[model samples]
Target: MTPPDLSRRALIAAGVAAAAFGPVRSAAGTEPGPIPQDRPVRIAMILYPGMTALDVVGPQALLAGLAPGSLYCVSEAEGPVASDTGLSLVATHAFAACPPDLDVLFVPGGDGTPAQMRDAALLAFLRDRAARATWVTSVCTGSLILGAAGLLRGYRATSHWCVRDAVLPLLGATPVAERVVFDRNRVTGAGISAGLDLALALAARLRGPDYARTAQLVAEYAPEPPFQAGTPAQADPAIVRAADAILAPLVAGATAAARS
Candidate 1:
């Protein structure tokens, strides 16, 4: 039985697990399914302040929802990580203290971008850890941190739309303005919500299209944002104008700071 005290967050995690994995039912709903992953994937996610919850939560949730395997949180220090939303997450391990068994390493970003950008030690840790992993991925301005670590030089990537231009040049990357960009072993997702799309896509890439499609069905992956402003292309001219005006300086300043 699901725990009574389990928050909606936990429930969502459980639901996603039901999606990507579980007994495989064929698309025609008439044949037995094959195993998706051949081996367990060890994932270590960095938890930092101001980090967008969805950025980490979406992927972490996806992995957690998968068959029981190894997933742990890492940080500069072990303890609780406070998010931009004011929610605190408990870290299971420290950066330099991580085990040598990590298969995937991920980081999420936020307004904390400015501070994390200046963290040379954290950047170094990311550089070292990512070098060993099978793949390294980021959400939102997490790309900023990776670029800061010098891992993204010559890589084509994407990030939250507002931060793409600022972050791309910092790493010598060509910014792809799409919601997700996969360049060889490095995968990046734009903004916060795009993390789920990227993760699902990664699953499809790694586990095969059928497995990914199963996950999408289980999670009801169709998007239906109630607001028209979900994308600049879909928003009114005035709203887009106001948003650009409000965000321009912040992007410009961040770009300048990271370049220096």
Candidate 2:
């Protein structure tokens, strides 16, 4: 089945697109329990320098609501990391310092992602946790990190259109250009802000479709952007070139960062 596709603009215009919806804590009547309460939903978002805040923080926000107090900001460092936009974000845990058990692991992307893609230490962190994690996910170019770790070797995944070309060949991943893509245990979101789509999908899968629907209602995920085009094939050629021009340096920076 063809998964739904959405652009970052669509997400912003909606403000989730709905207003009256309430917060969703846990999926009612759907709990993957029988495990210890000490674990606390265990979602660790990996942080890096020059990353897009939306790619990491947006989904984390939604997930944060669902699992309050459990959402943690883990990093490969001990201090604040510089974002793609030059914002410094404080990290809670370093890659090597995180706990042994993580229920979910999410990686976000941005101008720093390509550099993160080739980071052996980061890849090892993912690989080590992936062996025991309940779910593994990535946002935007973050999927390339998963591919670099060899987790998406045969899966159809999604990433930001600007970076899909780079991610496609690295790990034999069938890179699908979509808002969100899921292949069993691995879930990925597209563009800078598509993390919400991926998170809602995970919410549905982890709990139930109703949980996702409820979240959609709460997040107001119904409205589409004023821009008629969501997919590149459906967009005007000029728009593509314009966006490409904007990302060229960031892409180059990511490349240089990764190699250095």
Candidate 3:
């Protein structure tokens, strides 16, 4: 199914109209706005073992309210999926059960990404769904998965700062050093925390700035990082070295997998 062309000007006009005259509600009192279009926007987020928790949850939290009853957490099976941080989340649907045509198909990165890049089933699912998805997105190392699936070739994308330079080139994608990179329908976020930014940007694109702002306010999405070490450039040289050293093994494995 073809997704609607939600242009920025149209969304802005809609937001302005709603603010000026309030939302046009039916007798049932439902806010039948852009979200409740011909069909709800189908959003599917992939889950796997040893994946990062915050990477998925952060975006989910922001986008959930925007499209209620349209978000899905899918994996190979419908059961508890373990994360890199020892936390487990339940997958509501298996990959096979997910809708074939998705408006947004998202993948999150974590310790399991290197292994997931090699999983034929997961990669095949991503490849198939990405072909039909209106927006294919990833957070952190998840962009590597999209790259490995042959989806990001020739696309300017970003990933976790550590492995992006080493891995994206192997998949023929240009590595970009930024918090978020949008190349057509493919949107990628750097590191784990950047998911929030990616989601907000997507929210604005899908609904409007006013809708995104409402969701942000509901989420209390204010940020005030106490430390200036979110990135290598912001942190001390020694700290950057230490972080690189700790992630060396994972990066090496991912590099080797990407090359293979």
7 Cα displacement, candidate 2 (Å): 27
Assess candidate 2 and give its TM-score to the true structure: 0.78
Tens digits of per-residue lDDT, candidate 1, 60-157, equal 76555432345778888999999987988888888877855455678887767767877888888888877666567899888888888877788888
State how far residue 79 of model 1 sits from its true place (Å). 1.7
Q: What is the TM-score of each predicted model, taking all chains together?
A: 0.80, 0.78, 0.85
- As a TM-score, model 3 comes out at 0.85
Native-referenced Cα lDDT, model 1: 0.72
Over 4 Å off in model 3, which ranges?
Answer: 1-38
Among the numbered candidates, top lDDT falls to 3
TM-score of 1: 0.80
Q: Write the per-residue lDDT of candidate 2 for residues 177-236, one digit (tens) a residue.
A: 788887766788898768888888786665456545655765677766888666678789
Q: How far is candidate 3 from the true structure (C-alpha RMSD, Å)?
A: 9.3
Error in Å for residue 185 of model 3: 0.6
